[model samples]
Structure formats: structure tokens, C-alpha cells
Target: MVEAVHTAVAGRVRYRVAGLKRAPELKKLLEFRLSRTPDVTHVSASDLTGTLLVCFNSGNTVEGLAGRIAAIVEEYRSHGGGLAPGDNPGKEAGWLDTVPGLTPAYEAIKGLFALGGEQPREPWHTLTPEEVLARFGTSPDTGLSAGRAREHLTTYGANLLPESQPRSSWEIFFGQFQSLPVALLGAAAGLSLLTGGVVDALLIAGVVVANAFIGYKTESEAEKTIRSLQTQVRPTALVIRDGRMSEISAAEVTLGDLVVLRPGTYVPADARVVAAHHLSVDESALTGESLAVTKTEQPLVGVDLPLGDRRNMAFLGTTVVRGRGSGVVVATGLRTAFGGISTQVREVGETKTPLQGRLDSFSRVIALAVLGVTALVVLLGLLAGEAPRTGSEYARRFTWARAAEL
Candidate 1:
């Protein structure tokens, strides 16, 4: 049932629903019921704020709508409604008490995957430092202790995207043969074998293998170059751990880790600014904004704000060109925006090029032609050659007649 009601804007009334913090499903149920009411143009609910927005039809008023909606909700609850199908309220409180971190994880997951889930891209520009700390379950004074940090690292895994397993040389070589031209070459080799052209078949097979190897070698070399560049650019980070400051490899930084940002230092992970001093970041690498952005510590209101406008968040791989600040690392490795992109690069399946598509069509035509030619050759051979079986049958019959006469 609604705990309170207030006008959020003209023609829009907001209801503070009770028990929404515990029973998130109630929000949807409440929305479902409220939207069905006549003259209600729209209904939207936020479990985070325990509020629902109800818009009335033009010329219609929400003057008495709040009381009416509240009465409907209270009647529904009085009749034992709004419970999840399998839920037993009697045991829910006990389970919540027994489970450590279950409630928080539930809330986090809800915020992460909900319709408007996912923390603001640049929350630093939108959220206060204390709010940031509260959001991540950390403190500004002491930072996360060693034990807690280790637990989070273990739970979330290293703050990085999983490295794709290196493809074996044979795998790379075979992958090149997946193309249309190679398929056509394979068909040609098979036809040669069927026609008793053993040497010719072997020659075509050799060419196909050589071409695969050349493509593999070229790809492998390019990967090697990229790896070398990555090693050369690998950055170090300054972080506060167990209440003391230390410099560590960027890869070691994990979620909830407090990272110290300074001018001329590369951002180690995706983090929100908790403290800043004229903090201006050169985000051109990520946002293409040539001018360094000035950041501040203030809570922002809204959802899904753009990255460039999220002046409070610092992304990994970006350099702090001016000023210095501290940020709580919210994402590491593959979970970071940069890492998300890298994972996409690896997971995206290769698409057929336009040339490959045309070549595939050509290969189909060639295969059909080969089949037609082979059938014609076989027909001609059968017509020209004597029938061995018929000749044998006649010889056997003549032998049998001779034996009987003798």
C-alpha cells in the first residue's frame, strides 16, 4: 500500500509504497494495478526510492486518485495478496537474518540488472563522496582492509576481463580454410582423387595447406606486435590498502579499492572520484574530447547519463593530465567499460566479407558444373566399354553345354 503521496510534477502524482524495500515484486504489482485504473495515462515505479509515478489523462485530476489507489492497495493486502507465488512470509524474516550479505547482494543485483539497472556511468559527477563510499560499502578514512579486499577480489575475480586462450597454430591454420575459396579448392582436390589423379590431388592439397599457414603466420605476428605494445604501456597504480598507501600494478586493483590519482598517472581501473583538487582528465582516448574535463565531488540525480558528461567518473587507461584526486574503483578488468569493449572485440564472431559472399556463390556454381561434367564423363565411359558381366555369363553357359555334351 502507498505510505504517502506527493505531486512530483504537473499532472503527475508520486506514491511512496510501503514494504517495497522488502517486497520488490510489489512495485510491479502496484504498477500493474495502478495502470489499469481509468484516466491513468501512465504508471512507473522505482524500487530504489520506493516511489511510483502515476500520470492522469489530460483534463482529469489526481486530486482524489491517491486516496482511491491507497484504498485498493490496502484491500488487496488485507486479502493476502502481493506475495510471490512460492514465498512464505513466515520464514522470510528468519532466512534474511541467517543469510549474511544476501539482502545487499539482492539489492545490488536488482540495481545492476533492473530496467534502468547499472550504476550511472559517471556517478562521481553525480554522487557525493559519502554516497559513493556507501554505494561501494567502503570508508574514506581507512579504506578497505586486507581481509575484505581479498574477499572482494576472490568474489569478483581479478578486476580484469578473462584473457582469451591463445589459439593453437593448427586451430589458426584450420580457421583460414573456413573461407569460400578454400572450400572450393577442397572440392577440387576431392574430385581429382575420385578421378585417379593422385599427384594432382596432392598438389592442390599442398597449396591449400600452404595458404592456411601463410594466413596463420601473418595473424600470429600481428597479435605478437599488439602484445608487445601492451606490455610497453602496462601502467602502475597508487592505492590505499589496509589503511596504508602503496604503489602496485594496475592489474592488482579490484572493486572497492581506493586508488590515488595524480597528474601524469594513467587510470588503473574504472572508478568514481571521491575527492578532487582541480581534477581535469584527458578523456580523449575514450570520449574524443580534446579538452580535459574538470571534475567535482557532488551527487548527481538522474539515470543513464552520458560518459562525457559524467565528469565524476574516471575510466581506466585514461591519463590524469592535471590535478590529483582519489577514486573508489568500482570496476576492474573485463567489467570496466574498456574491458567490456575488449570482451566485445573478442566475442564478436567474424562476419563474411562481401568478396567472401561473392566467392561462395561462385563456388556453388563451380561445384554444380563439376558434378555435371563428372556425370557426363561416367555416362560416356559406360556407353563405350564392353559389359564384363555379360561376357562372363555367356562363357559360363558355353562351358556348361560342353560338359553336358561330353
Candidate 2:
């Protein structure tokens, strides 16, 4: 059995339910609440088991709907009308309180009021579908079909993954020139000078500094480019508050806000259009098509429609190119299509660049060569007749012997 709640502010609907034989009274309470809600225009109730499916028009607001639902739940609890069969062995218990243990259906409803009407903020940092599958050990395509993947990529721009911020200029500057090669060169120079090879030490030190400078420049430039891209792709959205439309940063938007969308505007969140007049949007970000899609104010019947096919809805990061519309936000940040996509993208591991790979290999080769040269020099000197006499008497004896032989 299922009971559904459609919140206007969120533009998303969630379901709650109890099984046919498990919690019949809970289903009855949900039906009673559905009957009392004036905004609920359509309700399909099961005669045998008391399952209720309720739908609200686009004109409803999320806060308004949530308030009404909360009141109904509270009323049922006070009057002992929300008791489910076998909830308690001898006495009646609040069905809403115990619903989480009964099934996953009431979890959404329970979560709605758990924090005293303060909704959970969508996580700004999210992973892409690919990432979710990879992390959970599921097939990459299991929950993310090809069409869904494409939608996510298009809507969120390169998948809904949070970008890594580049290191600050100071960090980059300090980190540059600090490499194994440079360290080794410094060590070699210090050792050579201590052993009375000042000229060789200076030469090695110069080479090390020069190599450090080159590597530092390359790495710094790469970091700057990445930072620039991140700034360029950041999006802003238009929203309506207190009956006035204004532009604001997307991060500031919350659930239940009304966002205004027009040509060239990006949809800031997941929303259901309450007002649309010949509204056409470029959903290619989520749909992977260059063609603009016509949007309507009609209700969507199925939850299975791919984000691209949900004509009644708009998603974050999608552009409005050809029409005008206003929608009530249902999901923001991580709950939106962009957020979901971002979650997936986060799972893809970063791979080393070709240049990086080549440089690593080159560094290894140079290190091996230096070690081999040092080893050969030390080994040859030891093997040849360059051994020093141990004590003064030994040296004097060797000299006398040599002189006598001469």
C-alpha cells in the first residue's frame, strides 16, 4: 500500500505506506488527512486495504502543504486515530512514531517534521551517477541507464561532481621548486664541498635550481588554468521572493522558493512549473540535445519519465532559450538533477596526464643514473691501489720499503 505527498515548494513528491495487513490504521489516517486537504484534488483510495494516493495541483506551496500535513498528523496522534493494528500489545500507540520500524514508506514523512520543520539542506558537494555506482559496488549502468547518464551530464555540465579548488598562489609558489631532483642536487653539492670539491658542488647546485625553476613554472600554469575554468562555469539563478523577482547566487536558494526563468536563464533547481507561456527550455545539459524543449503546466503522470521527458519540470543548470516560466522549487543543490550528476562525477578517479607520466619516468631514470655513477666511482676507487696506510708507523715502513726497493 502507498500514500504519497506532493509538496509544491519542492516540486517533488514522496511516498509513505504500510502493508495491507501490517498497519491498516496508519493507512486510514493518511486517507483521512488526504480527504481534509483542500489542495488535494485527486485521491485514489483502496477499498480493501485503505491505501491512498493523493495529488495536488501546481498552485500549492510546499510550506502550506507541509503545515497542513503536520497538523493532520498531530491531530491524529492526539485523538489516538493514528494507531496501527498490533502497534502495541495492549494499548494504542502513535502510528507515525512507529512507522519507520514498520516500513520505509513513512521515513520521508517522519523526516519532514523530525527537525521541527527545518528541512534538510541538500549537500552542495555531490557525486555523479557513475561515482555512486562505483562506490556502492553496483554495476555502473545498474541504477544509471544510458539516457539518465546523458541527462545528468548535460544538465549539470560535465556531470554533477564538485570541483576541486586549486591551491592558493602562495601555496603554489612555496611548493614549486621542491622536488626530489632539487633535494638530491643540494645534498650532492653539500657533500662535494665538504670533501674539498667546491667547483663540482657549485655546478651541481646550479643545475638543480634550473630544473626546479622549469618544473615550478609548468605546474603553476596548470593550476591557474584549472582555477579559471571553475570560475567560468559557476552559474547564477533568478528567483522571486516577497513577490519581487531578483537575481541571486544559486547557493542562497532554499526549498519552497519561487524561481523565475526566461530565455538564456539557467534553471536553478528542480521545480514544477506553475506558470508557463510557450515556455521552451534548452535541456540539452540534461537531455544531450541541442534542440530546445517545449514545457507545459500539465501534471506528469508517471515517476518513470526520464528527466528529459518530464515536460512539466525544470532542472538546475538547464538553460531557458525560447520562452518564459515560473516554478516552485522542489529540490535544490544535491537533490536536483545537477546534484545527482555531480555525485556521480565525484566517483571517477583522476588519471595522470601524459606529461606527468613522462616526467615521472624521466625523474626515475635520472635518479638511477646518478646512483649508478656514484656507486661506480666509489667501487673503482676501492678496487684500485688507492688504499691509504692505516697508522704513522705503517706509512713510514711502506715509504722505507719503497725507498729500499728503488
Q: List, residue by residue over 1-406, the lDDT tens digit for candidate 1.
A: 5544777578787778775544545554565556556677666666555666777876556656767667655654654555655665564442223323332323232222212213234435566788778866787977877667665655665544455565667777778878655675676666556655566567677877887778999988776556444433435688887789875546556678888889998898888888999999998988899999997766666657787888788998789988999999887776677877786887786577999788778776765565566456546756988333553333332222222211
lDDT per model vs. reference? 0.66, 0.54
lDDT, candidate 1, equals 0.66
Please write out the lDDT profile of model 2 over residues 151-243, one tens digit for every residue.
Answer: 332332321224565567667656654555555556656666665556766666566566656766888888756654443343556665444
TM-scores for the candidates: 0.53, 0.43
Distance from true position, residue 167, model 2, in Å?
1.7
Which numbered prediction scores highest in TM-score against the true structure? 1
Off by over 4 Å in 1: 1-125, 134-142, 227-233, 342-347, 352-406
Off by over 4 Å in 2: 1-165, 168-170, 173-195, 213-236, 275-278, 284-296, 299-306, 343-351, 362-406
Give the lowest summed-lDDT range of ten residues in model 2: 397-406
The clash count for each model shown is 13, 20
